[model samples]
Target: MSPWVADIEAAVDSVLQAYHRPGLPGVSVGVLAQGEVRLRKGYGLADIAGRRPNAPDVPMRIASLSKQFLVTVVLMLEAEGALSIDDDVHRYLPDLPDYGTPVTLRDLMSNQSGVRDFLELRLLCGGNFSDPATADESYALVKSASRLNFRPGTAFAYSNSGFMLLTLIVERLEGRSLESVLQSRLLSPLGMTQTHLARSDIPWLAQRAVPYVVENGCAARGEWSIPLDGAGGMISSIDDLLKWARYVADPASPHAAHFRRMARARPYADGTDSPYGLGFTVMPYRGLDSFGHHGQLPGVFAEIAWFPQIDAALVLLANTTEINPFHLGRRLADALFPAALAPRFPPEVVPPGHYYDPGENRVLRVLRQPDGENYLDSAMTRAPVEWHQAGRFRPYWPMLHLQLAAQDDALVGHDGPRAVAYRRLPTGYAGAPERFTGTFYLPGLESLWRISLHDGQLTLALTGRFGTRHFHLTPLTDEVLIATPAQAPDGHYRPTLRITGAHGQRRLMITTDRTSRLVAGEMLPSTDR
Candidate 1:
C-alpha cells in the first residue's frame, strides 16, 4: 500500500502502452525496490497470428542478459570455496588451445580475455551459428582462433566466445551445464519457476512471445541463427525477472553481496580500467551508481537496470530487435522517479547558434575551439541519400521496431542483378568543411580508428585488431556537431561521436553507441604509445 507502488505501476503501464505497438508480438516488464517487486506485467500477443496472448508467466528468450546470471553462479561457487576468479582457464579446460597467454576467469567475465568473438569471425567466414546443427560447432571455431588478440586483462572487448568458455568452465567444474547450475543454486531457491534456458525444441513454450524482424521494410521473423546459446540463451517472464531483481537487490541473499567484489572496477593488464563488472556493465545514471545488463539476439531486446544504493530497478523486454528497450526503460524509470530525471525537451527550438546542413552541402565551422577540444568521426562511409532506397535495417528498423536481421557486408542494392558499391562523404560545421586528422584508440577494443579531413569535410576510418570501420561527422561549432551514418545502409552499425580534448590525448565520447563500446576514444600521447 506504499504510495511509491502506485507510481511504479503507472510508470510501467505508460511505458508498455507507449511502446507496445500492434506489430510487436509481445513484451515483458519487471520493477522492483529494496528486495520487493513492485510490478510484473506483460502486454500484447505472444503468438500474434496464432492468437496466443502474452502472459506474465510465459517464458521467452532472455539473450545476452543471461550473462549476469552466469556471473552470479561463478561468484556463488567462489563464495562456496569451489573456484577462484583468478584461476586460469587452462586449469579446467586444458583442451582449449594453448594460446601462450593464460586467460583467467576474471579475464573472461570482464571481456578482456582477448579471445576473438566466435560469432563475428564465423559470419565473416560465411558461417551461420544459429542453425541448430551449426550451433554446437561455434565453440570449436572460437577455440581454434590460434591466438589471443591481446594479453589478458590489457583491454576490454566483449567476447561471446569468452562467456561460452565460462559456461564450459562451469560445466567442467560443477559437472553440469550453466543452466543446471542456475536452476539449482539460484532460481530454485528464489522460486523462479517460469525461467528456462532455451533449447532448439521448446514446443511447450508455444505461449512464448514470437520475435519479429523487418524485411524489405515489412515485419518478419528474426533469424534463429545465433550460435551462443548458454551465454545469451535463457527465457523468462516478467514475474521471473521480478524475482531476479529482488534477488539482486537483497543484500542478505547469498549471491547479492558477492557482486560487490565483481562490481568494483578493476585495472586491466594493459593499464586501462574497466567499468564492466562480471557480466554487468557498471555505469553512472542520473548521478547514482547503477548495475545492469542488456541483451540482443534474433527476436529479443531487453534491459535490466538497478540502482543498488536505492534498491530500485526496472526491466523491459521486447520480442522485436527493432525496439529501443533502453529508451522505453528510461521513460518508465523517469515516470516512477521523476526526481531523478530531466524535464522533456520542448519543440525544435534549436539551441542558440546551432547550425543545420542539407544534403547538398558539406562544410563546417567550429565557432569556439577550447584548449581541450578533441575531434572524432564515426561514419566514414556515406549512406545513399534516398532513405527509401537505402537498406531496410539501417536507421529505422532497429530503432523503432526491434527487428533483427543479418547485416550482410557484401550486400549491394541491385535493381536487376548488379552490385551497387556505395560510399559516404564528410561535411563540416553548418555544412562548412573543416578538415581534421588524428589517430583514435578504442580502449575496449585495443585498436586504432584513424580520421582524415579534406576541404573542411571529413572521412573517419577505423582499422583495429578486429577489422575496419567507417563513420561520418559534421561540425557545428569549432567543437560541436551531429554524427550519424552517412547513409542508412545495411552492413554498417553507425555510432555518433562527439570529440573533446587538446592537441593530443584527446577524448572522444560516443553520445550513442548502443553496445557501450567506443564510448571514449583517447589518443595516447606519443610518449605513452
Candidate 2:
C-alpha cells in the first residue's frame, strides 16, 4: 500500500476508536484509489456477545449506496440497446396511475418524476410494508393519494420511491426479478462472492453482524421498510464493494468507460434545475464534484463518496445510527487527503430555499421553547417535542408552517428537501382534544411523544430511553398550537406543532420546538393548572 493509503487507514481507525463506545457496535471501512482497493479495515465488535470483531469480508446492508449499482445496470442495459432511460415507465408497468402526464425512467433516476414518493404516502395511510410485494403497495397508495409534489422534470428532491419505481420497471422489462438481474449482471460478473441482494428474513446475515437497536440496556435485532431487490436495498461486504468499485472506476476494466457516463450529472427534464446523474448523487460537496449516495435503514448508517477527478473514494459503514458515516468519512478525507480533497462548505452559507411556501410562513412564526428542570421533571406532552440530541433531550423550535385550502380538512405536506411526506390533520382540537394526547413513536428515531389533556388544554411530555418530562400545549386556533415548557427559568424549550392525520389514525404529527436558555424573569407560560 502507498504511504498515503497507510496514513488514511490509520486516521480512520483513530477516529472510530476515539468516538466509538462499547454499546455502539462496529463498522467497516474501504478506501479505493486509482480503481482498486488500496486500504480495507474493520473496527470494534460485530457481535459483542461473541466478541467478534468486524471484518472486511462481512456483509452489510449498503442501503442507499445500492442505488449507484442498480442505476449502473440500467445504464449499461441502455448502452446495449436493451432499454432507454428516456422510456416512459408505463412502457413496462402500465398499471401505474396516469396523472395526465407520463413519468420517464430518466425522470425517476433524477427524482424529477412528479409522482409522490410511495413510502411517504405509505406512512400517511397508517399502512405497514416491510417486504418486497407489500412494499409495492406504497406506490399504489401514492397513486390513490393522487398528489404530486411538483411536475415531472421540475426540481431535485431525493425520493426513494422514485428509485423503487425504477426497480419495478427493470423487473418488468427484463421479465426477471430484480434480484436475478443483479446477481446475473453485476455481482456475478464482477466475482463478488460475498455480496448478494438482501432479504428481510436472511438468517445467515442475522448471524453475520446483526443489525441492532438498544433499549433499556438491551440490544435487539431491528429491521427497515426498504425493499430487498433493487434501488437502495442490496447488501455486501466492504471487500466486495471495494472490488465492485474498482471494476467501475478502472479504465481498462470491461465496460468501465461506459459506466462513467452513468455517473455524469445531466440536465433535468425541464432543464430548469440541477440534474441528478443516472444513479449517483452528482453534486459538488465542498467544491469537489463527488459521486456517492448516503444510506440509512433501521440499524445501519452508511456513505460512499468518490471523487472521480482524483480517482479516490471512501466507503464507511457503521452498525449504529449514532455514527454518521457521511460526516465522518468526509472529515477523514479532509484530514488524510487534503490536497485532492474537496473544500469544506462554510456553516453560514445559506442553502437555497427551494421548498419554501411563503404563504405557509405568513401564518407561522417559529419560536424558541423553554427548558425542563431535568430529564425526569420535564413534561412530555408540550409544544416543541423533545428530540434526542447529543446524549440528552433538548427542545426544538417548531418551524411553524401553514397551507391554505378552501376546505378545512387534512392535507399532505412534503418533508423539506428530502421529499418525504406527512399528513396534516385538520387542527380543530376543541371538541376531540383527547384524540391528540396518546403515545406516538418517531419512526427510525424510536423516540416517543406522550400527550395528555387536562383543564381544557393539552399537556405534552417528551421521552426516550432517558425518560419523561412535560410541556404545555394551548391551541391558538383551528390550525395552530403554542407550546410552553414546564421549567422555564432559562427559556430552554419552545414548541410549535402541526398535526396531520387520515382515516381513523394520525399519520404525521410533528412538533418543531426551539431550545433556549433561561433569562431572568421571563415567566414560563404554563398550562399546568
**Each prediction's Cα lDDT score?**
0.59, 0.56
Tens-digit lDDT string for candidate 1 (469-529): 4557555555444443343222234344455677575665442212222334557556334
What are the per-model C-alpha RMSD values against the true structure? 13.4, 11.8
Indicate the residue-level lDDT of 221 in model 1.
65
Query: What is the alpha-carbon lDDT of model 2 when measured against the actual structure?
Result: 0.56
Query: Residue 427 of model 1: what lDDT?
Result: 41
lDDT of 1: 0.59
Which tens-of-lDDT digit does each residue in 462-492 have in candidate 2?
5533245566876644434555656421122
Q: TM-score: which candidate is best?
A: 2
Q: Indicate the residue-level lDDT of 403 in model 2.
A: 17
Model 2: which ten-residue window has the lowest total lDDT? 514-523
Off by over 4 Å in 2: 1-6, 128-133, 204-207, 214-218, 225-227, 269-275, 342-529
Cα deviation at 396, candidate 1, in Å, is 16
